[model samples]
Target: MTTPAIPSTLDVALWLFDQSRRDDVYLPAQKLQRLLWLQQGGYAAMNHGRMLMPAVFVADETGPIEPTVFHLFEDSRPPIPARPIDQVAENHLVRMWRRYSHHSPDYLTKKITQQRCYRDAWRKGAGTVIPFEAIVRDFTDLPTGDQMVRAGDGRALKKWTPSAKPAMRRIR
Candidate 1:
């Protein structure tokens, strides 16, 4: 499937800034742009896996703008109970970290398994917002390994090594 065009950095910046203002969150435009850029590859239309073109326009704070696109992976077991996109967006950064990062807390309690880190924080009255940069930094620093799948008996399947990298070409 063809990848959709990514939004210009400026447009994404503006939209993020507006969303932050409306939601009373203190996110800055630069930070929003960074998040969008990091998430671009992961956004795609459901089932088909076709990437959606991202658009950002100047929008009134109270009026509806465009719906945002998100990627959905098919899972036999849904990790968390279904919820609205806004809530999903708010919680997903931490959820993704828990799934992909090695820096997550070692203890595997029911509370941590059932709720995203920020959601757990809210339940405990901490009322903290984890920064986007912290998530990004941790994700990027994760060690690379052969991607694995689960087998019928619940053990990880054999690893599949990736192909060799292509030679770099010099443009004349």
Candidate 2:
């Protein structure tokens, strides 16, 4: 059997936009970027290293962002044209939204920024590309991360608590 076609970044973004409209809620571009980050990274973590979408995420000041997708809402106004996505991708998107939509944009940004993958990939004032491998490494290295991914809620994966050492920069 042939491999199924993966949806473009635009298609995925539109699907997310549809969800926002349906919920009658406002979803900022930053939150949508984080959701896509989770969708691609978390899905790969659980699916034998397969990506749900072939999008490249960069370490933006706010969090991980797919640049192409971000441009769709560069003005913080979403005018993305809707398009159909594969059923499988649609399902993954739905699950990600449910798992994360409850949190505010700031919360999501803080959560992702604190993670090792985002931390290591980010450079101050530079939007470095967050490689898929880096994301996989972060989750797999976390406590119970694999289990969390299997449960389809990578967001709930255990966080990295700092060890007692020289008090480095304070978090929060």
Candidate 3:
């Protein structure tokens, strides 16, 4: 079994909080959960089934949620000390931020719930676990170029590369 890249979900969550704070954005409880879910799945897809953090996601009525994160920060971020995540995990989290941070919590909910991973879990029953394998399966086949693009509203995602060099400057 591949070990998780990050030691704990809380550390990753704290990193995400720091990321949002750096961006001058406010992260809601639900948004934080959905982002965590996306990052975990994205990390698995990118890293050959290795989990980014030891997070267990359940299908909630709204969307995917990590219960530990939800219970602790349901009202406000608790006083838990933030741990320093390794550079690798931080890099992955930054990639995830670029992918989904612009979207709203509602958008994430709508898109994520439609995914097979979440659908299968919800069909099983409320609070059913969305297994990591299932999530990896759902994400693994995405074209590499589109993996970082938000899967908006169950529609096919268009690849966007911000860092790609300008296309020959149109040969002006």
TM-scores, one per candidate: 0.26, 0.76, 0.82
Q: Which ten residues in a row have the lowest lDDT in candidate 2?
A: 145-154
Best candidate per lDDT, number? Answer: 3
lDDT string for model 3 (69-166, tens) is 89987887777888878898788788778878999998888878778888889888889998889988878765543343344243555445687665
Best by TM-score: 3
Q: What are the clash counts of all predictions, listed in order?
A: 0, 0, 0
**For candidate 2, what is the TM-score?**
0.76
Task: Write model 2 residue lDDT over 33-124, tens digit each, in one string.
Answer: 87777777666665656767778888777788898888877655466567777787677778878877777888877777878878887764
- lDDT of each residue in 46-118, candidate 1, tens digit only: 1123332343311212111122311111111113333323343334333322233332122222212222322
Cα lDDT listed for each candidate: 0.32, 0.71, 0.82
Candidates ranked, most accurate by lDDT first: 3, 2, 1
Q: Which residue pairs overlap in candidate 2's backbone? A: none
Candidate with the larger TM-score of 1 and 3: 3
